[model samples]
Target: MTRLVSYDEAPPEVRRVFDDIKRTRGVPDVNNFWKALAIHPPTLERVWQNLKQVMAPGALDPLTKEMIYIAVSAAQGCEYCIASHTAAARAKGMTDAMYGELLAVIGMAAETNRLAQALRVPVDAAFRAAPPPPIPKA
Candidate 1:
């Protein structure tokens, strides 16, 4: 039988963090991922803190960040992350049309990345030997 850790069964430190997360996020209970991470409370706490801080409104707009997240998840083929982040992106103001386009772009990028990897394409010798592009004049 599959085993899952109940929040009450979590380690002391994990329980603390889980309680805080429940209070802050207004969730009923922790998910399986966190329950597994609860085996290492410090790592769980650190990851939770970092995720909250990074995902909060910041210099990069939340929707944009969510788009970036969705793109990365799609590239990595993380179905759970793609679903979650896509929902987050929609919540942050992504339209259906925008989501469709975002998905198309990610798909194209993934295909190109795979092609590049498969061919082991090397950089043009001249491009590699040349200095970086000059900055545009103001």
Candidate 2:
């Protein structure tokens, strides 16, 4: 909250990233998160690039990615991220019922995760294995 660089106040490099964000998202302005990051232009550019790439559709659909982001944000108790991604998910056609179910799942996971840690549960042999192989190329 200390430093917020608006588009008018941003350096050319920061403005470039802001432009991309607006253009890619089809919006008139970049959000406050980007404005905050614009204080550090290099990091702003890097994070923007990474976000664009990661949020692009590949294996997971865009809506699913947004929902995943919302879940992680909720787990981390980040109000900004939760609100932002929840808006995105709603824009992508998430129903009210889906939002309710997602919250329920998050609560259940938190309960189970804490219980497991408290009980010091050991990993089952059947569940221990090498990471699954990468998806085959088309």
Q: Pick the TM-score winner.
A: 2
Candidate 2 ranges beyond 4 A from true positions: 135-138
Residue by residue across 59-103, what tens digits does model 1's lDDT show? 699899999999999878888788888877888799999999998
Clashes by residue pair, model 1: none
The per-model lDDT (C-alpha) reads: 0.83, 0.94
Q: What is the C-alpha RMSD of each candidate to the true structure, in Å?
A: 4.9, 1.4
Model 2 steric clash total: 0
Query: How many steric overlaps are in each model, in order?
Result: 0, 0
Question: Residue-wise lDDT of candidate 2 within 5-111, one digit each (tens)?
Answer: 99998889999999999999999999899999888888999999999999998889999999999999999999999999999999999999999999999999999
TM-score of each: 0.73, 0.95
Model 1 misplaced stretches (Cα beyond 4 Å):
1-3, 118-138
Error of 1 at 75 (Å): 1.6
